[model samples]
Target: MTIVATSTSAFYERSRANMKDLRLKAESLQAQVGSGEKLSRSSDDPVAAARLRTLSRLEKLATIDTSNADRASADLSLADSAMSNMSTAIIRAQELATQAASTTLTDDQRAGIATELDEIQKDLLALANSRDSNGHALFGGESSGNAYEFDASGNATYIGTGNSQSLPIGDGQTMDSSMTGPQIFEFTDANGNTTDVMATIKALSEALKGGSTDPTGSANDALASLKSGLDTLSTAQTVVGTRLAWLDTVAERNTNLSELRANEKSDLGGVDMTEAIASLQETLTILQASQASFTKLAGLSLFNNLS
Candidate 1:
């Protein structure tokens, strides 16, 4: 008969290894419970970790898109307000022109109207050069300076770019932040000639101040041009309103997408506290039983039995 003998040291070593393994498993579960995360490291679940990384990147991009959308909305709102005030000023100018066109008004009255028109021109220029929320030109079309500038002869000229800047909101969507100065102020008159609100007001004021052969003729001529400029401003306001509406839609969509991403992240990475705690308790119970068994077995020996 063949006999196999196991050394006491080998038995102790095997028991220690088994206890160590249980201890390690208990510790891992505890860490998971405390940290509230399923995977402690990427290697724990590489696929889930990679998906989490992608979700994090998308969240960052969504944040940027939200910021840009907010800025664009602000600038567009400012432009809309400025245009509303400008429209009011233009309507007032038209009324003043109608008064000046009447032959019953005295020279002094016409001069008084001219003074008010000059003030209105300055107001228009200020509105055209209005600043945005960031203190930059609102109608300058991405330029840093004013949208309009006056020459030595008091002629107002548009110095802004031809087109405004377009900002990306999200999901491959983009919108113009604001309209250019010329888009709001300049248009084709009834005579098929290009004219602007500021220039028309300045010319009318000059004529009323004796710069023209016939002041009433000049006032009548400016009415058509002023009306055309107001139409252009109104059209621009509609465009801005449409863009703001679109931004609102994009914001809602982005919010939904953000919520979805958060849910996905929670599903992939978040630990279930109830399950983790139950598993940890079960593991600890097994470890304790094994430890007690080892303690009793280790104390048992042939010498003790003989004693």
Candidate 2:
């Protein structure tokens, strides 16, 4: 039977290609074992690579969420402290009203108390216009300036937007970071009258200075208004405190989720050094055997044993 002609050049070419492929595979395993990563390119395992990419994206998002949570918590904490101080100021005003309402104090003494109350009013206004960590007005509600502004009449008017500031703390979760100035300082009393604490204190101060015919009655009214303001401040503090607690819960959940994602990423892309090393050893043995066979075959040329 006539044998089909097989070119020596073709044999050499095929053997070189096979040997190169085996060497590349062996090197790849070695790299995996050294670097502790499964693949250097997405082409090696597209599914795993895609999953890893998604995990990376989520990790970045979680970091951002955590920062937002921290900012919101801090802002709310400042708000609580400020409200607590406001409550204390109102309580002091209440005490002064009780003392001033007594018939024992002279007009001069009542005016002195009013002067101090005016100073407290100034303090309250400053507190209402307090700035946050970012230098924006804490109660401004998207406004960069003071939350409450004084008119030409020296009447305090809320210039801030009525909406409260809110922040995203996690997936599908958002929290109000601040309350409006009006909501904290201007609350309706049981008599259905809108009570402005600043104005009430100012009115009380003026009444004590003999602006009202019935100074004792005005003091009693002021005392009642101050009590309402205390309630408003306490409610605001409660709201802020509740939000802070929610943020803490969200923060914990985010941390746990981040850890879970990291573990999954490790499982998907991390290399098993022991398995890679064993595979590299097997690949090297196969390459060596193939090289020896090729070398022996290459030595047997058509002209080697020709007569």
RMSD of each: 2.5, 3.1
- lDDT of candidates 1 onward, in order: 0.89, 0.86
Q: Write the per-residue lDDT of candidate 2 for residues 1-307, one digit (tens) a residue.
A: 1122345556778999999999999989988888888868999999999999999999998888898889888888888888888888989999999998887889999999999998888889989998877888898787889998778976778898878777777787888788888878887866898868998999999999989988888898888888888888888888888888888889889988998998898799988788888899999999999999998987866525431
Total backbone collisions, model 2: 0
State the local distance difference test value for candidate 1: 0.89
Clashes of each: 0, 0
| lDDT of candidate 1 over 1-307, digit per residue (tens) | 1111345666678999988998998999999898888888999999999999999999999999999999999999999999999999999999999999987888889999999999999999999999987888899988889999888888988888877888888888888899998888889887788889988998899889888888998999888888888899999999999999989999899999999999999899988899989999999999999999989987888524533
TM-score of 1: 0.91
TM-score for each predicted model, relative to the true structure: 0.91, 0.86
